[model samples]
Target: MSIWKELYDIFDKERSRWQQSSASKQAIAFELKANLGFLADALSSGLSQSAIASGLECSIFEAKLKEGAALTALNRRKVTLTFIGEFSEFAKYVGKENDALVENAYSKIKSLQKLVAAEPNKSHDLRIKSLFRFLVFLVAHLEEQPLSRTSAKKAEG
Candidate 1:
């Protein structure tokens, strides 16, 4: 199977699992993590294609995909950061009382951004590695949060 197809399947599975489970804050976080994973894979795959095209001296399609992937990655990163910010505000409003968690998430996001900046003209492999690291940190943060009442009910059911 193509890497893109595999990534889509993974994303679908994660989304399905999240929907079947209780839609808790942590569950939402997991969903976001899945999304980030999908984007990372897509971006990496596109970069690989670009590299292949360059090596093979192929047509323009690969270049287009490469450009599109970069734009997609940038947009996704922005959206992810925005979502985290909004989630943090919501946590505060609901009295979830976890400033540290929000701070940690922000820290990871900034770290990922810095990594991208450090290698503006580097290989996509490096970016993919950084993305995986970010995902790991994100998952750890999500795991630390308390499960919602709905999640508990779903688990019991």
Candidate 2:
């Protein structure tokens, strides 16, 4: 019933429909592999999590996802790296595990970069969409996780 699970089923259906849909399957699988720790850390360190989760700035995140999906292979590379750099720097001052947070952010972005880099433009768009869907789900799911919920409670209490 969770959104993440539904999105996951859609991913499976896509892979089945496309047969050897390597790019999409691979991208979606990699994101699904992300541990809860990494997801919590990424939400804490990512620039737009709070805004998107709060429904105040979903537009920017949506625009980025849409634009990245439309970008050519080379431009996707540029956009991915730009995001990596921004997330890396943003993670530095986010909290206690500064180094590890940067590493986590770097790892996530680099994996997406690799996915985007390996596929042609036509297939790359699907790769971007798969990753974007995972991210959107993350933003929403954080609200239901102890990670964000506990923190919010602490701040309130």
Candidate 3:
């Protein structure tokens, strides 16, 4: 089966299990997957109102999932975001929307400018932090569609 198909299967199974479980945690997981799947389908079909609604639902579901995940992940080793580079690539890749990201970057740069003016010595850290924040925003934006298999191969290279 295609990777997307496999993922859909996995998500479907997990959602089913979650829905059946007595645990609120499982219910939350089910909701998260449902929203994610809806978002994926919507984006694939070209960002219709349904897709936007799904994305918004996913955002809400994520809040709950995050709380659960955080409790578990807190005990695990933390992976730094530095390896991923900037979130702009993610924004470009997933949401395929760049205008808002461009505006965000512009705003961030302006804020950094003010900071730099006040304390030139901290510019290095400020730049790094700004880059990290922008990248994270972009990454979250991109989590919607993902890349095509052929494009993924090119990206890996």
Candidate 4:
């Protein structure tokens, strides 16, 4: 199956899971975070720097619109996905010690769902770009972790 189809399927399943129960929401958030992390690693390893840089430039251009109106009209789905990416990083940092962090991640994921649902007219390309941005943010967070502290914590654990 195409990547777009796969992503759509995952989104559908996650949305359904989100509606089932509180536990399901947690599960969906965890699954999405793991999937995005894996995608980030795969993209980082598979794609050339130039290709990634070009994509980043385009996203930056869209983000930097000087006109306040244009900026306000930015895709809500993308904004929500970015928030999900951020919450994922926070959850990773807090680990299992903080239920609130995980809950916040789930909440952001739900917000993304709502945005997508409300904006059914959004293009597939927009959704894919949002997902890519999320993965990039996640990868950056993973790479930002201090190795010394991480190792020390692991040893303590």
- Could you tell me the C-alpha RMSD of candidate 1 in Å? 16.8
Against the true structure, candidate 1 has what lDDT? 0.43
lDDT minimum window of 10 residues, candidate 3: 70-79
Best by TM-score: 1
Q: Enumerate residue pairs that collide in model 3.
A: 87-135
What TM-score would candidate 4 get against the native? Answer: 0.27
Point out where model 1 deviates above 4 Å. Answer: 1-31, 43-102, 114-119, 140-157
TM for candidate 2 is 0.23
lDDT sort, best first: 1, 3, 4, 2
Error of 2 at 41 (Å): 23
Q: Which scores better on lDDT, 2 or 4?
A: 4
Q: Pull out the clashing pairs in model 1.
A: none
Query: Which residue pairs clash in candidate 4?
Result: none
lDDT of 2 by residue, 1-157 (tens): 9999999999999877555333433333243334333544444566343222222122322343443422121111112222333334233323322223323333555555555455424344343333443443333232222123345459559
Clashes of 4: 0
Q: Distance (Å) between predicted and true CA of 43, model 3?
A: 0.9
Comparison by lDDT, 3 against 4, better one: 3
lDDT of 3 by residue, 22-139 (tens): 3543443344345445444544566543224323333323454454432221112222233233434443333323333433443454454465556555424535344444543433
